[model samples]
Target: MKKSTRILCNGALATAVIAGLSAFASGYLTGAAPWPASGLTALATANGPVAGAPSVRKTLLGSAPAQARFDRIIVRYQDAAQTRSRPASVLGAVNAAATRAGLTGSRALAGHGASVLDVQHVRRLATGADVLRLSRGLDRGETDRLLAELRADPAVKYAQPDYLKQRLDFVPDDPRFDLQWHYTHPSAGIDAPAAWDTSHGDGVVVAVLDTGYLDHADLNANIVAGYDFIHDPDVGGDGDGRDADAHDPGDWVGGNPSSFHGTHVAGTVAALTNNGVGVAGVAFAAKVQPVRVLGHGGGYTSDIADAIVWASGGHVDGVPDNADPAEVINLSLGGSGSCSQDPVTQEAIDGAVARGVTVVVAAGNDNADAGFFSPASCKGVITVGASGIDGARSWFSNYGATVAVTAPGGNATSGSDPDDRWIWSLGNAGTQAPLPSPEGDRLMGMIGTSMASPHVAGVVALMQAAATEAGRPPLTPAQVKALLRGTVKPFTVVPPASKPQGPGIVDAAAAVHAATQEIPVDQGELLSNRVAIAGQTGAAGDARLFKIVVPAGMRSLNLRSYGGSGDVSIYIAYERVATPTLFDRKSAKPGTGEAVVITQPAAGTYYLSVVGESAFSGVSVLGVYQ
Candidate 1:
């Protein structure tokens, strides 16, 4: 059946841009070992599922706050201060800028931590940048003028207001978060809450190209105007052909009811989250554009192709230009046949990729090779397979080389306890048409590869949004696919299917953090041998790496990391990076602190790595040698 590819609805699964938190909040990715030759590996962990701890829920509404005032500014000079006594040249430039901006009482204080400034030294960065504080917070205009004056000085390389940073380790107040084991499970889940600390997919838009969306309070707020691309009136189910209205009229046929498949998928990608309502979406702050292509007896390849182009900002002959074009497109619907045999669909995917849109598609549910599916077999698109709560490939998901990654798509076997294994999201109760009353709004648990595709799409949106918030350019389609394939979480068990299920499960926190550019490590800063640096890492399964060199005369070396919330494991490797699975010296305890000492240590480069057993913060990595 070419119809939206028969997703099992009976209790089965399916499927941030802000001033991002510091790069360390999610941890920076260092060059690491490549995926195993077989491509996919099972995650070998001793941890079990986490029990739910539902908290008091609250919602925030109203317009956003006004522009912020600044009382501190970080100024970097062309030269470093060799001595602690504030350099005379640096003092003169600061005084000059203060005077030019009509400010008084400017003097350089001792460099350290936070302190009020008439004009004073805050602290010196490893790169020799100076943090300066003002007497009081200045309004936007005054701060701008002050920055301009500071930048005008020949000695000043750069100057900008020091923005206050909030903790990025956010836990949403959504009541349903407790029910979402697919997000909270330490070994099997995606670790989305910790990633939320970095970004909320703020400005990115994801187009859900499938059956049209239905009206539901949980999803309506994040939805934008989308076009109906069902060319045939019979297929559309509506009285007319393609139109701007993307509302689902239902696609019931005899005994089967309307799947409301697209609504569920869109909800997974981006439902109104943290609203103290029903469920939370992966990229809740992102907008979902509903481009209806599947309907009645299923949609034509031609219709799906045109919808892809238009949603990605390309123009169709009679369709209007998409104003809020999507940065990501989720096709939770697919058909049989190789991509080469479907030239139009392949061409459309190519065009979308050229336009810089990341295309994500389902790897079908035929329990066969994904290489035989249309969009999944198509090049330039991310083919997503389905996995259950156990982190194994879902029983019905398509597999093989073409599948890029697996996501939580739920599994409801006939006699097994599938209640906890289903993917939960927004849905409607109407069997064949739009249900009347708010009572029609529903929350459902479904299982299928159709459900898994949106999970990857949501992660892509988070990656793009985090990149933008971090002041980095959006990743190209190729880069997005690579990032996803590179940052996946290993399945807990190998798939029993004959073929492999691509790389592994998609990890939201890992992928989002990896999307940000890593800050270059400076070996020069570690010459003192006795230094402590503050660092952080996202949810369990996320990791950070640090490199240090030992001098020849050192008698002993101590490496310690302490004072962090949440559990973490530390690993030490000689001359190379270490991971949870590959490390020389290791500490895999339950606490936040880990210590390892080396007596008569060899003189060479050493790698210290911290792998999170859970989200951690305020950790101090100390290195000392005597």
Candidate 2:
């Protein structure tokens, strides 16, 4: 995030709420101020203690709806008056302290500035090295001990976990899926390419932002059209507009620290293979467009916001717009927060949602709750949290009511979910000679939801592919989200597990079939939110996508996955990038299960793409608004 934060929500202006109340009672009484626990509730944080979910038979949706009420405690180097001149010393200091204090995770670097080496915004102390955003930990003893330690340390400027806040809604796991993936890969469930020959994400064009693509034999044909977004960072590359794709090293060499993420993300969405060697993507036929935004010192918030608009086929002053519109946009990066909305962040997301595009975002690696990040907490876009193949929340994933559906985004101990981990994909050699004969082929092994997100995107492409071929209008982002949400299956993970929700594992076979279908909500189906609720109740292949009819008089809908106890917490959905946004939205009821509010111009048929909280079951009710 840039230092000049604006146009989004609140706490985003400056990541500076971390220095409050680490002092003692006397210290608090003297110089410290009172905490606004009540107001803070507006921006809530985590609830399951730390690094886990609640223990229950059915996972409940939304984190009790209270995480949004907490005040956000942001922390950053005061010296960072401007993002450009943030100062490296501050980042160095923070990293030194973090390492000394024993905070383990990705090591920090002087990527953003000088005086401000690095900054971290957290929802709970469950993760991070130095700074944190902790609300009152239910355990008084634990809270007190942590407070004492923070105050005792001189380097620790100040601490306050209970006062500030932020809000994270529904989000999810991987990228859009590949089209042809359903074929060959049994997980996708399709027996052969012919099974999907009638349709696949062929009509869908997905843009992959990263280093220059290899233009390999299998991949060359699938690429619809692309441009180089990478302007080259000093650390690597010829800084050329489109250097002939060459030998890129590391799962990330040549590609700036920023570009590497894009490549990793691409493989997850569309790697190639059916003809022979390597892994298969969710939607192999979907077009892959590469956009390079993260080239140097991370990227500026402005560039990303622009990318969002561009990715959706919106015009950008200088950059070439994504000629073809995408139904979904995926984001896997963010700054800290305690559930507080950043105006700057919101605007960008709002702009995207305003269009018909559905945005998919990462819930965060904070491993605490969805109330931890900025844009992911936005109300509209789909906010995704990571999970293990075992159906448990990844130890590194942030869970809360905001989370939509969970996908296999490898964990801290492992990488992508075992089912998809080390899965082969086309290689991205930054800029080196081709394979076997300088112009040959090879594969790359990578991880992270950055890698997983494309899988989801690929699925979206196939859904679009089916819609196009079947003589139906292409689905809006909302419709796609609804389809994917209600289709997820339940997988279980017990204690000693790092993730809160186990894999719940995605079923590509199921999703591909669902994509081939076009559930038409005719005139008769319109005006009411009552779809043989009982008969319409069954999660398809995605686990996250479910089917429900809008009941009459019910304007709003609420789907919760309630866990029986604290020892075991299942999730329904991970987060929502924004509000009232989706691939499709029929008449929905006013939330709170009270009254119903209809949004469709007139009473008509509508379908909700199911977004899971943890592992939902039981009365997944849809209310109609009056």
Candidate 3:
């Protein structure tokens, strides 16, 4: 077995009455506010007591309905109206729509000032749409009615609610090598050691769309230039709107210092490693681009959408172009709502994916179905859930079919021994500012689906780096997500009967190893007849590609692999080589009895691959078509 190179380590913006909002914010501050911590009883610091706090499980675990109210609406006018019409005329058209909806008339918003109107323009979006803030917040029904009326206008292209998104975070406790068990634990860990031998994500850039970065010795070296996208000064807490500085001035809404949430998150993605320093990060050698979107309270949907596009190297109207485009974008924040309810945010995610960026998001900390969360439920993104030391779904992790995979997000509530269950990463000791001694306050232990999302993001960086090092083109977002789901480690503990937490916990080593292997076109065997071909895969991550040409007018095509001693999976695709990540159909049942049947099959060459989910021998592959 390959050995690890370095020392071990472990470790919404939105509103609505988010159950754990206060606890999440104050719990992670300088001292213990309310959340649980290590075995140590309350340890007092300059700020206050910082340990042995009571668990907010009841408050944190329950699902809170997303705020079903909106104070703004986004609209995109038809081409001529948006580009050619006078500002007054556009305002008139919008007011006309508002009148139809039984709302008051409105005025055009100034270039850099506020306005008094029932529906006043807020700003333009990166996608060329316009945002208009209402005089007051509207209930769900009222917002829906307003949107309908706006969309009914002849000059309107589309109209959507401008919802708010909150960070999907929770406060964790304790910091030490033992507490970092999520990195190397036999059953619960991600197996980062084996992956480190192959790739430390040296050349990849991962964009963290969360609170801005706080300077920390362990993470500063791995952080690249980032941008602050928060436009509301009240939320920014930086006394200004959007600017070039991504420095976190603190996001404390109360008497405590900031939570240093982004710093903790960034550390997990790419903190400096093997430097005889604090804690090790998942993709320690990768560069983290901090894209600040969430701040005090949370952030607006429009700012987040713009950040998503800009982080992936797309153009945002006012922001400068990203010099370092991210291969992976981690969204550790979200709001309570279905993806369909927020088309603007979904559109941004869609655009980012189309640009070939692997978007990873938290399934949410709500124990309910992940499909209820924005971005988590959005299409073309890898939604992740949290797992615990026992290898079961974390108590607070959102579950459902939408979750792509699980990772160690820690469960401090597991039994009484909660000391080693939380994830330890870089953090700050100062409540509102950096301490004089950087190293003293550089470590933090935290848990949440927020933490879980970054683990997958880091793994993606490693995979992309490994593939590039192997001389392969970068994997597309779909391909990356496919590999992650296909290579997950099966859960050791059975999850709740109804809530499915994806295939299993993420296996970093398995994912990276798979990313490094590619099948050559010339190596594929051609199936000339219906005779069963016997083959074997030497070990897990090994695969055998095959090609079969189906004649025109084929009514059906069937393929199967059976009689294997160990586990194997079958993947089939038309006209292209099939791998786990790039397959049209796949069957990965236990052992090796797998089959794929296609009705009204397309007339073309079919590619089939038998992959070893574990070492397998004496596997027989047969294909039949009529």
Candidate 4:
């Protein structure tokens, strides 16, 4: 991460919010503050937080919705079984409810004027019961009244306005995609080009919770409708706070105008690709939901927590239910606190995971252990650290046991070449020299765990899309984390101080490949001259079986075994049907390393099985034929 030499304190901005918006501005400074310098290295002090960096302000404008439209409602019967059996009964019930709500109006028949109840069209939801579209125009009050009347029906399950969902097409013609080394570079980047061959992330929505977004030619089309959770106008910078518009105005402090951090993060996840204009996105076809929680100086933990719930399709007071909930949530911000001491953030993450939303958080840029951070230390999140072009830990990345994976966050260390080390993404020209108004979009380079996290999120989008295409169930957050850890490419060189960099740098190609693989048979086994398998036992008496073929002219079979943090035993049987006992070649090693070799004798199929000495033990086995 590159640290700026200049740092300024915006006392006036902090004082203004402290006076007028105490509730929203609590526990945080007003201006864009950088993370405090650490003792790790002199260059470590150069990088600040990856968000809201010092830059000139740019007046990027976005158009607002013309008028609110309320002309439809989604209705599902209370008893799905009954509704499926008698569809007509539910339709009749809806008509009766509309009539009782005084919304009846009809056309004349045969030159005679007569009134009739309005019934425009009824459509069935793919998974639910039905959604009714009323006549074109209706006010909020009228729609609410009609919904209330429908809810009065005992048979009606749920009745709410069918909110408008706009599709922003994300197709960029940006020509700078070729310069994005982080996508295709061999040693320094996640192999995005190879992963793209399998999936382009269609049918997946990723929620980006950051300092909101900007309207850029390269990014607008792929954005979905999202909400602003910044409750203070000072921090929000949009004059008013916490409204429907999620467009970022600017988060300028004294020294830093604004990082446009949210926009950069969004572009990394799903920027417009192959439109002949800008850089390509990791998941080019995935939609992004920009949920604003950070603005102005910085955001509060409370507002960020609420955004998580709303983004995951959970209800919050005074906030409308999300029409397009995300399958993946990316949070690129963090504060200095342990998750164990921060239950508010932890609970929100827990809730999001319970609802099947995979949350990916940055491991922070503090050059310290991530265990001291809030969301990164949270149990269920896929905490990510940053690596550089050389695939070494970024100078400013946080590390610890909690980190699940690492990605290319770029390095701006002293003497590091910018062309080879920087992560380039969409940004405002104002972030460069000579502060200007009305910021025009440009490409900028940055380095931090903040940058590394979105790579994982984008790869998750690819995995989810592939899983859907393969007609398989979506992976749970735990499963997603497992796939990421299990498939990472080992580091070419071990990191300094033996820091736990998870399994290795995240491998997008391997993750997607694992997600889309066909479900394995219960007793299926891998075949090769040498085979290695790693797994964990579920409960007591749980056993995993593998079959190996010993050809007629085979020389010898060799086996080695190891257990992780628990007791496990390996058994080999030459017979076709009988379960092997201790009488057979059983190696019940006390721990870790155990080995057994069979002489060149038999030539048929043999079974190798692993059984846990106790519940939940981890095991690894190696089979070799010579």
Per-model TM-score versus the true fold: 0.56, 0.51, 0.76, 0.58
RMSD after CA superposition, every candidate = 24.4, 18.5, 9.7, 17.6
* Runs in model 4 lying further than 4 Å from the true structure: 1-178, 414-416, 431-439, 519-626
Candidate 2: tens digits of C-alpha lDDT, residues 1-626: 11211111112212211100010000000111221221000110112111232221211112221222222232232223324112253344434444454332333223212222234432111111123322222133333333444445454434333321111111111111122222233332223243244445675667654433555554666655555433224412445533323223222223211123444455456555353423455566676666544332222233344456666776654455556766666665554553232433454555666676767666665556454565556646566655544445555566654555666554424211232322234543222332342243333333344444555666666667777776777676656666666665554553243233322434444555666676654212121333323212111111223323433454445432222211111122112211223332232222212122334323333333333222222323343333
Error of 4 at 558 (Å): 31
- lDDT by residue (236-269, candidate 3, tens digit) is 8888889889988776655433567788888888
For all candidates in order, the CA lDDT equals 0.66, 0.40, 0.74, 0.64
What is the per-residue lDDT of model 1 for residues 220-259, given as tens digits with 9 covering 90 to 100? 8899999998766876889899899999897654433456
Candidate 4 local lDDT, 1-626, one digit each (tens): 00110000111111111100000111121112332211110100112222442322211111123124454556666654454424466557667776666666442221223434355444443224354655544555566677799777666666655432111101111112224567766777788877887888998999999877887777888999999987657767788877888877765554334566788889999987765445567898999999988765566555676788899988876778899999999988776656654455666776898899999988876667777666777767888888887778877677866677899887655222444565667666542121232246555555567778899999999999999998999998867887888789877666764366676898888999999976443343654557677754322223456667777767788866675554556677774421334325777767646666898948876666665443333467778887
Decoy 2 TM-score against native: 0.51
> Candidate 1, TM-score vs. the true structure?
0.56
The stretch of ten residues in a row with the least summed lDDT in candidate 4 is: 16-25
- Which parts of model 3 have CA positions greater than 4 angstroms off? 1-65, 78-90, 105-117, 154-157, 173-177, 255-257, 414-417, 433-440, 519-626
